[model samples]
Target chain A: MTGQSTGQSTRQSTWYSTWYSTWHSAWKEQPLSFKLSSIIVVLVLCFGVINPFISYDPVLDVELSRRDLAPSWEYWMGTDGQGRSVALRLFKGIEAFFFPGLIAGLFAAFVGGVLGALCGYFGGWIGRSLSAVLELIDTLPRMVFLVLICTIFPPSILLISIISSVLFIPSIATIIRRKVEALGAEDYILAHVAHGFHPLKIISYHILWLQCRALLTRQMIFVFSYVLFIETALSYLGDYGVQEPYPSWGNMVAQSRISAVAWPWALPALAIIITIAALLAFGDGIARREEEVKR
Target chain B: MSEQTLVDVQDLVIEFDTPKGRVRVVDGVSFSVSPGEVLGILGESGSGKTMSTQAILGLIGGYPGVMGGQINLNDQGVTYELLKDLPSFISERRGQPEKNERAWRKHRYAQMKKLWGRAITSIFQNPRRSLDPLMTVGQQVKESIQARESHKDALERLNDQAQTEEALEWLAKVQMVDPARVYHSYPHELSGGMCQRAMIAVALACKPSILVADEPTTGLDATVRAQIVHLLQDLIKAEQCAMLYITHDIREMLYLADRVIVMRHGKVLEQVSANDLKEHALERHEYTQVLLDAAGMIGAHDE
Candidate 1:
């Protein structure tokens, strides 16, 4: 038994090694710029998680007297009107902003993608019904819907993300639907069907994987931008992270609105602009690199 | 022609409904193959050679198309009345039955799930389109094996390991040297001939009883096409599997097929044993002679 088990493990490892070697070779063949951009995006996502816990306290700090201090060693990104450190606020904001958006985006993409693929792959009634639903969603004023939902429900970070994600579903579904329709016509799918593969297996194993990487890269950028926009809008309206001790870039900048005549509370606002610009620039770079890899 | 007919199709008719109205693509065609026999269907580009066999395999793509025929598989003693049922209905009959028609339909739908990569397989004309670009040659072949049998034993002790071993064997059988290295390489990395060989390896991995090859060597260079034809012939003989070779190349049909069926305008024009071509020469079916002349096999019996 022991000998057999060891031999089994050896074969399993060999299979894994074979898979790994092929994957690694493909990755290694990618251009240097794509590799570098992918690395940077991964690092930024990691930092978003780690920065709040290890580096700073984004909450529970106040100095009424030192409110709106300029950038200094004491407060690297200076302070908001509430005298909270902008660096700490930015770190925590990253956490609150990224997570809900990522979760919501992934959920929406998965639902919409599967639905779209089914519609495009097995047409006639199924395709028609899905297309009708998608078109109905597309015709709605999504931003207005988000605002109405946010007003009806409590204005928490999670609720806002869900609403924002729901708003983007129709658009994403449309993109995925077109892709699946085109891929359904590809010869590989026909060949698989000719070999008598089940429709479900053809879609899941072949069609889904064929489109997944590109879909993911596109979704990442769209979700990232939309999350930041929604968060900013909510913060400006004094609906999100509104409690005094809690810090969000939107709310921090909103506080400085009255004191535009005073010292640099504008530093937090600058941080918001800088963060958004940086993330968008970084996302674009990553998107370009992904395209380069395909080439 | 029975050495036990492996596949028998009788009175096959395929029609497609278009905006212009219904038009027949394969009108009243019938043929059969004995075990280890190669049956060639020869035609021009729009002659329905591919459609006739696709109907047999129950793989007609949605073109508002309908097929009516009786296909009998001698090994299983099952007769599939293809025209009487929809493609989905025909598919359901592959496996054992369930309690009701609905239940059986579900089972039949599930049958493709179970039978693919095992019972019946196909090789296509374009190797690049047929192969998954992302997968290594070996993994693609292994995927077929892994998909077919659920091996519960330890990986090393699994009986299905023989199937993977057979994939490499089939690759070597197709004259692919360095099968190990080729197995690890992606489809794009290989030449057209090598890709076709890898495809054959996957098709034959499960030792399917019948292999449907649709213009399998159509786009290949002459030498490569000859090699593929020879490889397929040898594999079919050694495995004792029936082959449905669809082609427009009459020379290839004559070289490789044991029996030949010529199709034109969605109908079978003539059926002849490969050995009987010379005797049939005086019976000048004009179209058939034209094909024979085009293939450079016409005799000096008449102008």
Candidate 2:
């Protein structure tokens, strides 16, 4: 009974302490970039939440009568060439961009981490061949290669994300390889081996799991930023991005051109810039925190 | 208990292949360890004490090249070769070292994991870096205890409770007064001496026949070192386990070892019983004589 009570109290204390520290470290005394990035992310999340209820179309619902309008209370971010609410379009664009970026980020990290673990842990012919393939992909111009693949098949958010994830895999894999190699040499890992833990278990649970938690989160954000860049570039070119009627930041900015007295593409362009910057700053914050802990 | 050989390692040879030639790191080293025996294998840093111990664990091949000989262990009336049937290096991959290492590791991992902790365990040199920083002391000890068994329901109720109970018993055995706190704390929360004691508890958790302690007290300060050494000595007697105490501190072996084997450059130069060690006449080899002279025990004669 005494043992149980002691266990409970210790458990509670550890739990409370962990929660308190994470918040204090991540929020309080953080740099300006970290605060600004967090605010941007929260704003984006707010838009994503309210986006589904908003009824606004930038493509087909073209009120030619109200072609160019400035910012107003009725039309908060004004109307575009197609009489679409820019504020409404901004929310939808954020939703479209963030969703695919998130998917691509996860896919890239998973593939990269697994491939890199295999290479570092199980080396030899398998590692060598996979490394060669990664080198082959590394030299190709990302935009041109993505365009080529998209053109060959019907391009959408799914196809573009798949291509971008594949492109990001090698770089992420390289990072994971270096991490795994260094970690594999650590004595604690060898201790696991001495304790009769399986090599696969050692690789997955002990070596990789503990080390890669924060690292993978940071890497995914970086990958998310990359995916965001690719999506916007493809959208601007009017190819391989989300089609018209669906307001992707890329297409909303792409299918419309900038003009004096009416900047149709301005809001989406600015949204793209802010979202990418937010991702980078957030990732950098996490990375910096990791470094501090190491010291 | 009557004297019975728990470990009989025969003519062990460990070699690494370089472009120049096949270099033998540990050549034809052999020793037998009986139960309740504290046999010190004293040598310098590069004298292959640790590498030779790896051969006993079927881990020498984990690096590269060839390892030949038998590491026989007698467990429950069944005698088995710990280093037998391990794949030999093929000449086909003479040019490619990576393929050679990959092939060796696959086999070495399988063979080593079977005999690890259950049959033979080790306490490493650096105690702080040896414990996993993420896991609590209790969790690590529990894993070592559970490793002795084949398999149990990991998610079953009270499984953790039972493991913790058993782990705390080990902590208590290692003379840890506050077992409860030590069990709950992480590696970083403990001092270096405390961590080393925890590591000993971890090693003794399984109650294996042979414990290889490779310079286990190297990093501890003077007072803590004496305490830890005394703790280990008492535990070895109480557990009746054989210990291959590998260390470079030649003078300290007298306190811990019953019989000492002096090694130099991967070869056993002299093996002396503790009684004969005091006589100094048994240390015939020039290096052993030189070491004893350096320790100021044996005077050099102007022959």
Candidate 3:
């Protein structure tokens, strides 16, 4: 009876069955730390991607009458200096942080993937020169550089994301390049070579196919969190980033710069911390899993 | 079975520039295989058997040292000046080598890629490692078949039912019992022998006329090894293809090969028919006699 049922399920599910099994097995195999981090990362990603639809924050809702109120049932986490609901703005703040992070992460991953694969797969003057360029970028002080660039020419949100993404390329590409080098040495790749596969075919099918997904995903998540933190830091510093009249987590906290005892601004600061911590933890888990699978 | 020559390697010399300066790994190695012939290469570690095979396929990287020789595809009437034809990043980095070598290398690689997996294919020494971990045995075989096309043409064509069916047929030809199950399974999911069979299936998928198998059954246990050799022997006969079987096991060569080349110190010492090794072990070259003694084959000279 069970065999018949399994056959029916296999027929009905088709590709989904294999997909689900792979997914389930992967989840089942992860350590507790991986699971916990994955959960935190997933929740943050859900909030980041869907927060716009779920959150209705009036960034321009100036109500001086309700300014500086503490957390209450009606005004969750209280109102900011400009009478903006801190809780509502917190979600919108995530959306602000998230969209930029996503864009920058994607940009970095695309550029990094191509450059790294090419350099590692075809090592010569090309690889060396490209490596030299990456090294130059790598040596830059990311925090100070971004701050200086953004201050010199006040950046729009998109421009800020692009800058962060550009800065991220070196580190991400270094990881990808190292992976291509290591994977190139594996025997399966030699097998592909023996099969008389085109170098491009060997790269795409035999080498990059498995390694790219995990590497890119982990790097993307890391870049996302990195840009989010930098955006917040720049805005909080009052010179660059999302700027005023906007409801980002950083600017909201900056606008609310209150005495520590009152503790209302602490709310936005906490959200930023959780998001960054979750992203790092999630990236770490993926790295660990990648190492394990290589065994 | 046929007199047509398929592959001819002439005076191939491979030198490596190590920390200890230049050293020759394969010195003036020369041999050829006709269609439907099993030509065995017997040698110890570092005998250049594997290197010579790799040199034929341009697997050897251009380095501080160099390779010089010719690997000709007699049937295709194409000659690969194995030395200049393979891409060498090191050569480019070393400054001037007359850009002509690089162009020829690129041109040769492109031309070789056209014939790879179609006219010539290979099975490597390590069976399990030779199969992609993330892919099913079937997918790897199908991809090899697909590689028979132009790169752009391959992208437009995705996995079709016909290719999968053909892949399954190959698995069955390799003596796989449940071809369907094996087709869907990943390399890690199969046993070593099973993976070796799958490797064979993949290499044979495009019906490559010249198959280069480098120690394909080296590490398997006796039973599996015998079966694999038997299966390979049967298939090579059935397909009427030429095979360069590289191994150190003289017994295997005796059983599966028509001609056996004895190698030592990166050079071919003797080329004789397999039957002559048993009947005229001590009567041929000194190296062949040494190999026979090592194999414990008592000859008239042993007394």
Q: Judged by DockQ, which candidate is best?
A: 3
lDDT by residue (tens digit), candidate 2, B176-201: 75777887787888899999999999
Better of 1 and 2 by DockQ: 2
Clash count per candidate: 2, 0, 0
Tell me the deviation in Å of residue A110 in model 1: 1.7
In angstroms, the error of model 2 at A247 is: 1.2
Tell me which of candidates 1 and 2 scores higher on lDDT: 2
Model 2 residue pairs with clashes: none
* Tens-place lDDT digits, model 3, residues B1-303: 123667778888777767886688999998988878899999898998988887777666545333566677744554444344443433443553323434555665776666677678889888988888877777788777777544436566545555665666777788886676777777777899999999998898767888998999978999999999999999998887889998888788889999999899999998999988878776878877777778787454356
**Model 2 segments more than 4 A misplaced:** A1-9, A12-24, A45-67, A255-264, A291-295, B1-3, B18-20, B61-66, B86-105, B149-158, B168-189, B279-284, B298-303
Which whole-number lDDT from 0 to 100 does residue B295 have in model 1? 73
Among the candidates, what TM-score does chain A have in each? 0.78, 0.88, 0.86
lDDT, candidate 1, equals 0.67
Compared with the true structure, what per-residue lDDT tens digits does model 1 show for residues B166-273? 555555667777765675677878998899988887777656678889898877899998898888888888888878888888778878888888889988888888
Runs off by more than 4 Å, candidate 1:
A1-40, A51-58, A238-243, A260-295, B1-3, B75-77, B84-119, B150-164, B278-284, B299-303
Which of the numbered candidates is closest to the native, going by highest TM-score? 3
DockQ of each: 0.28, 0.31, 0.35
Q: What overall lDDT goes with each candidate model? A: 0.67, 0.75, 0.76
For model 3, what is the alpha-carbon lDDT of residue B93? 32
Instruction: Give the per-residue lDDT of model 1 (tens digit) for A1-295.
Output: 1222222211222545743553465457656544554565566588677855664354557777777677799788777666777777766766667677678768777777777777776666778887888888888786667777777877787877877776677777777778788876666666666555557777876767544545655675667657767777777775654344566667766766755346444655665565555555555554444344332
